[model samples]
Target: MQNRALAAATFSFVVAQSLCGTLADADWPQWRGPSRNGHSPDTGLMESWPDGGPKQLWIYKNAGKGYAGPAISQGALYTMGTQGEKSTLISLDANTGKERWTTEIGDILGNGWGDGPRGTPSVDGDRVYAMNGGGHLVCASTQDGSILWHKSMSEFGGKTPNWGYTESVVVDGDKILATPGGEKGTVIALNKETGSLIWQSSDITDNAHYSTMVPANIQGQWQYVQRTEKSIFGIHAENGSVLWKTDFPGRTAVIPTPIVFGNRVYVTAGYGTGCKAVEINEKMEVKELYSNRLMKNHHGGAIQVGGHVFGYSDGVGWLCQDLESGEEVWSEKRALGKGAIGMADGKLICVDEGSGKVMLIDASTEGFKEHGSFTLDPQSEIRASRGKIWTHPVVINGKLYLRDQDLVYCYQVQ
Candidate 1:
């Protein structure tokens, strides 16, 4: 009877975890943490760094020529870069920063800014998915880095954009979603296990941009929200049907991932396109809440903490904007230069693109208050002349990860 009770209790615990979407261990398994919101689900982190900064745990200096950030899951860190003539997906020990294995993605992508991949890897269960700049997507075994399946975005009628394919694929349940934007479809859903086509968003055929797709559950409906050069839209998860879309006059590039909270979706871009927010109703109606130039974030991603959004604007420096009213809360231009932003433990981590400087700021609406700051030691010498540090920061498991070209630095933030 005791053994029977233990079995029943274990079963109940598993069921509850599945229903709540809880994992046994903490993981930053994709582009922007678990939810792709530039927020880490980590607590008990150091609120302020000591004098200089957090303690450097390890620095693996051979990440290769790419701006892709690291994705960590189950003690393994995954990222992509270029090696010789091929783009490669690499896995490293999350604790010691030791190389574990690597698999070639495809031919190397030669671009003016840099010559390598750009999209981060997405780890789901025991399989990991990654994309090269040339639109080669591959799924491989997480344990051995063995290829399970592969596909090309060009096969789905996608035309390579000026910047290449920089969007990380979304893995949700049984489907993996990608934006291979063109006339045939804007987004394509494939069977996660077999790499077979599930469906495509045929209604909207905009060119793909650099932003990644975000999955949201709004109005009790599951959908994937994405931003392109022309519009911001949501597609039904089960089918590739377009639920709603709104026009966005994006310029040179629309690079930031769309942020979805509750029933509202917020998107921003650089090149003076500005930012906008729209709310979706249960009946699939879309209403633009506000549109303004308060946050013209180019590539550095934005984070939403509480009711405010924090990021670097083009004209303005580091700034915080009210998400509800589309107004500037505060601006701190001299604090940090244009770069990426991430959040953890009630604080914001900001990086400077020109110099590899990292700063910890209060994620508050009152003002731009910083707790600590540090610059990257031994910054990459092989970095392109025009390529400033573009990779976004990732914090999970009490560690902060930053990448500059081939140099990947890990700091103990606990």
Candidate 2:
């Protein structure tokens, strides 16, 4: 009887351990969360902020400056910044905000807009991927921040964009995809383990811009969609074949990544440019459904939830537009000035650009409903002379993560 009881307890322990492992694997492993659409599968998050906003759990001052955001996975947070002239990648303990390790990858390049690294580090399983403004792509180990492999975009026949490599590397299956923007090809897929070029998109060569690659299945086929200065192209994810192309009259700069929903794609850019919704047919043909300047989302990417797309539309203010017709449902320029935004539990988390105030609003088509607002007190040292809060806010596992240059503040949203 005693032996049987002990056997039953051991079996239950093994089952519970396996369940926890599976849950941890479902975390936000890379940029834009698990789906690369800025949506977190994390539930049980605080639906409303406290009166003065949730308590700041901790702040790590070692993180340098630039607009790069934090990538959380396996109990660790990865982000990039610059100290002096060298660009460094730092990893931190997600629960305690303690430094795990830091690695100097390359030199820092500055533009009129900002400085340091502008792209988020992608944490893939055992490897952490980061890109510097100087066009250096480094893949390091998650355990100790040791360099696994490194490659330069310029050396691989890609030119650095005006604002640097702001596109976060996308890891799909065994390959990592990036836009180098040169003669080799606009998009290239590299072996995630060995860092060798597996394939490059054929001669649709155009200069790289600020957008990241988004993976989606359109009409039962897997495709990688990206927007460049010239046009938007959907490439076959398996072999990098140009599936379809649509000309976008983007002016000055094209920064935001295209949002894909089913067979339709929505794209937007700032600086007098506008937004458009395009449909992809079964034969790989592109047709514009609606094009308008109503929601000119600058560099901040919009999210499609329910039936409306929510984002800050350049000079038009924070707006929600119909997913099919491109009609504005509501515009709230008076509520929150111009800035980037993200969605958490069906709520719009808006970060004001001019000021460091974060606002929570209802993500609805009815109108703008402000729930709570608070200024990010005790800002980072590196953010003293920097531009507005440029990094998009991220919410995961009931925690709110915001960045100002190198400093990252983690708050308990629940």
Candidate 3:
């Protein structure tokens, strides 16, 4: 009898663990996963791929694209695209890659590099938020494609950046924050429910750039960190007060989001701008630790794991640097050439910009190690002219999600 009771207890524990794993795999929620950093806490994924790579689960044509990645929430996938002259926000079935709904949000702005919406959509609990290329911001219901509230940055005394508003809205608690650059405010906090202004940053009045805001707990205080053309600053999460400012000599554009580890923050930009690490003191004052040009990431953000930072260096190829001293650890220029990156299960999902080839590499401080790769053959009927596969790949729920113009592809990674 004693042996039978012990066996029953072990069986119950295994069942409970399986249920907990299923619950954690259901959502991707925001721009860069749950923490707003490009890291997914998923396990049980295939560590290596076969010769032809993982099998494509499904592909949805006419999804449109302009470098906007997908935001998965609940059981739906949200992203933005451009159809002719109109900008659209689309929701797709997460499992099958079928279109659930598409809504015309605003007109598209033609740019030199490409066109269409450039920012990733952000989905809260019940509402989906998207910003268009022309500065039109809309909040729509996640269940159905219904607009809840809409506002344009121009109407709020704001002007669009040269490249467009590429920063995904950062939702903190009950407030939504955006960079509406102008005299009114650089960063505006609005009530998530009613779309009313709660507070605005009054310290610096500068035009918006292409970087997104990252939430960080610096020295035991929560703050929002953002980088613009001139500098990088931290604002209080509770009230939008300027906590600290560090002047960075950003040239053509400062596009990459900053990464914070412990009490130090690391920021990088392209077009001659390099990377820097700044230390935050107890009083919210920032001091420069070291600055170097080892990594000049343009817009594709960087991620930190262990004690190294991994990202694409503008002229040096994909590189890794020591997070503390800004020292170059290893640099590899062979696989995936030059492009954006995403991380999942201790591996790097790199998408080559010139060719639509995706490669999986081990995220290591030693050197680059390729485990698998596949060339994406997007259907000719749904391809874009100028912008190919500029959007970054997102891995979640044991699947790899990628976008190329109007086509969104999902492949089973496990």
Candidate 4:
């Protein structure tokens, strides 16, 4: 009876975890943290960094070459990288800078800007999903880094973008979503357990660009929001039906993930194109709220803290803009160079692209109030002359993770 009772309890625990996602509030298992918004729910973090920055906990110098950011779940960190002509999905110890395992996803991408993978890996309870530069999507065992199922997004007719596919697969419940951008069907949903075709958003087909898709619940309508070079759209999360779309004049690349607040969605791009915000109505339609160049965030995605948005713009440096009014609250070019940013505990954690500097700033709408800053030491020499620090800094479990080409640095930000 005792053994039977123990077995029953174990079964119940596994079932509960599978249904609840088993992801802690502080675990960042997906694209831009828990909510895919570049924000962390962690508190009690340092209000400001010291003169030199937070304490560097440990550094893993063999992370290979890639711009993929690290995602953490259950004390394990997952990221994609490249070694020689092969691309790999790496699993690392979140507390110590030690590699647990690596699964080679596919061939290397030799982009002139940089070579290797571009999208971060998404971690679920016991499995991880990653997409390679050439559009190969792989589902692997998080325990041993063994590939379970691998397929090219091109199979769905997604022609790889010129710069290659930079999308991280989105996993929801039993369906795993991927963008194979072309004509057949842009966004395809596969069975997470079997990698079988579930559905495709055929109603509105736009070729995949560099941006990752974000799941949304607008007016209680479940859908996925995404952007292409020429347009912005949302499709029903249940049946892959086209909900709504709007014309977006995005130039060069549409790389930043769409930011959703309430029923409104905000998107921005680079190469001269600007930003726009649209409201989703009761009938699942869109209404443009405002469009401007106040924040032309390139790949360093922006974050909306409180009621304001913050990011490093092209012509401008760091910027703070009002979310609802679309007004520029303040802009600063001196605090740091062009950089990527993450947010936690009402403070903006940022990294400079050119100088490889990490900074902590107040996420207030008042002004660009920098609290502290530091430079990433021994930066990558393998990067192109124009290639700077492109990896977005990630903060999870009171530790900050930053990566250059082949180097991954972990810092204790608590």
* Cα lDDT, model 3, residue 262: 88
Tell me the whole-model lDDT of each prediction, alpha carbons only.
0.91, 0.85, 0.85, 0.88
Error of 2 at 94 (Å): 0.7
Using all chains and alpha carbons, the TM-scores for the candidates as numbered come to 0.94, 0.94, 0.95, 0.93
Q: Which candidate, 1 or 4, has the higher lDDT?
A: 1
How many Å off is the CA of 407 in candidate 4? 0.5
lDDT of 2 by residue, 303-335 (tens): 888778999987788898999889989888888
For model 3 the TM-score comes to 0.95
> Which stretches of candidate 3 lie above 4 Å from their native place?
1-25, 379-386
Q: For residues 265-364, what per-residue lDDT tens digits would candidate 3 score against the true structure?
A: 8899999789999999999888999998888997667888888989899889899889989999999887667788899999999888778888999899
lDDT assessment of candidate 4: 0.88
Which residue window of length 10 is worst by lDDT in model 1? 17-26
- Quote model 2's TM-score: 0.94
lDDT of 1 by residue, 77-176 (tens): 9999877888999999998999999999899888889889999999999999998999999999999999999999999999888978999998999999
Which one wins on TM-score? 3
- Clashing residue pairs found in predicted model 4: 158-180, 181-207, 181-208, 182-207
After superposition on all CA atoms, what RMSD does each candidate show versus the true structure?
Answer: 4.1, 2.4, 2.2, 5.2
In model 4, the Cα lDDT at residue 308 comes to 84
- Greater lDDT among 2 and 4 belongs to 4
Lowest lDDT 10-residue stretch of candidate 3: 379-388
> What lDDT is reached at residue 85 by model 3?
85
State the lDDT at 317 in candidate 4. Answer: 82
